[model samples]
Target: MENPLTPDALLAGVRRTRLVAIVRGNDGPAAGRAALAAMEEGFQYVEIALTTPGALDAISEVRASAPVGCFVGAGTVLTKQDVDNVAAAGGQFIVTPSLAPSIEEAAGRGIPVLAGALTPSEAYEAMNRGAAAVKLFPASIGGPGYLKALRDPFPDIPFIAVGGVGLDEAAGYWGAGAIAVGLGGPLFGDAGSGGDLAPMRERARRFVALATQYDGRAAAESLR
Candidate 1:
């Protein structure tokens, strides 16, 4: 089924995909093709880095052609102008490597922002500034253990783990309480070199399975 759902619904379903594939392919054709591949693997959320050539146009075209439930967003956004551009392109969300007040302004207009942060303080500030969810960039350096430590202190805040994350790492992060995972090379996996997508799809499937298991466990624990 081609979803037939709204962007808001699509964004929510992104938690299910547990895979926000970041495509940094420099042109529209490659970016679009890569996005389609992710969607084919059951990934509903994909991010196009603004640093990529024609990134906004890629977002627009991808949004128009994406499956009904696909949630297309822009990454590497640093300013309110970038946020505006994302909204203008019909992007479902805005993700930044760092938090900016302009991102907050955009979030006020009903666009979701995944403001990136490294420390707990930055995460708190970003959330307070109206970020829909916080992105823990360079998570590879921090690792799942880092996310687990953060959960110890800030369980109330929502976080999306990014950077250096692989499909195989999904279950551990979910166990640590990540709301979603933002992946660049691993999920999108070498779009320029035309990397095979089979691994990516299998990874996505693993995430979906893990999330379902976690949901069930959470429910069971809640009833106890």
Candidate 2:
């Protein structure tokens, strides 16, 4: 069955939210709870990475519990089978750590994909291959300047900075033209430690505030 959420809608949601909370941990239940906490704190997009133990089940759990209009997607997707599994588990989107055939597979199934890329060539290739957006992995290494340079030539391609994206850096990436920002450890914290969720909620609130502020500023500037 085709997902009710279309690629265009997913893309628009990403642009509107501008923050993607990446949930990963050893305990599936904890991961699910963390996702819920993030959603409760106003994050509309969540990616449950396959690297987490029982991540598929976690995805299903979060999907079943997340409020309406929230997007639950599968992260670390590497194969066509992963795509099928995520779709079966009610994932509305796919996020890969690298540019792969999986992007094409997701596109074939009408599922939007954000494939990871580190260079201009890789990003462009991923876009050409049907990725809904390109995730600039380990973005901290290049920081916002690198993303700005990448956008210089291919301004049309949507970019999502992931891997090492701190809460403080969210606005910088948005200002640099990123459609959205993906955060893992910085957002969820060490889920393995069984820490309190209050910190996560605080972090989520901070990120959301920064993204909203920058997004509004950009929109206002566009009008002028």
Candidate 3:
């Protein structure tokens, strides 16, 4: 079987989750629990935010405990130090809230960096930076239509839709050319207060099911 959690394999996991929960809590335990729940719920990609306490430790712990198919990534990485931290923690990929030049430096080592972008120009520049994919952040404000518009000119770039993306709108974004979607509070709620993870797991499972259904339809059409 092909390995799906490798840095190069993040895209497949993206289709499965369509919703990556960014978790940052008071300590390693909280982050681990949140990340564990996300994986249990069928989410293959989990991001432990750099702002969280012991983020790298939490990532290493989660990476060790998570099922083989799960992809653990570091989020909100801003500097070369953050990149080194995640890499040392064994994180397969890195995600930033905004495009940064340091991100290019990190990705050069074969680590997949999902650089955030708000415009076509930004997205194109991010791709030029050797980014594995461009994250369309605050996508709600831009909307799925914006992604579709961007695709007309820069269709080859892999776009991960982020922010304000929920089950109700995931399909719209995917249909509009988004390769994946990143979700937060809606899926996991607040980490500081510690959410009821069982419900979040169910919600994540439903997202996988919904994305699978959409993929089925799309594949069928393509075969015709």
Top TM-score prediction, candidate number:
2
The worst-scoring run of ten residues by lDDT in candidate 2 lies at 215-224
Model 2: number of backbone collisions: 0
Per-candidate TM equals: 0.83, 0.92, 0.88
lDDT of each: 0.73, 0.84, 0.78
Please provide, for model 2 over 125-155, each residue's C-alpha lDDT reduced to its tens digit, 9 standing for 90 to 100.
Answer: 9988888889999898899899999899999
**Which ranges in model 3 have alpha carbons more than 4 Å from their true place?**
1-7, 15-19, 191-193, 216-224
TM-score of 1: 0.83
The Cα error of candidate 2 at residue 171, in Å, is 1.4
- Write down the lDDT that model 3 would get: 0.78
Greater lDDT among 1 and 2 belongs to 2
Spell out the clash pairs found in candidate 1: none
User: Which window of 10 residues has the lowest lDDT sum in candidate 1?
Assistant: 215-224
CA shift at 80, candidate 1, in angstroms? 1.7
Question: Model 1, clash count?
Answer: 0
Model 2 steric clash pairs? none
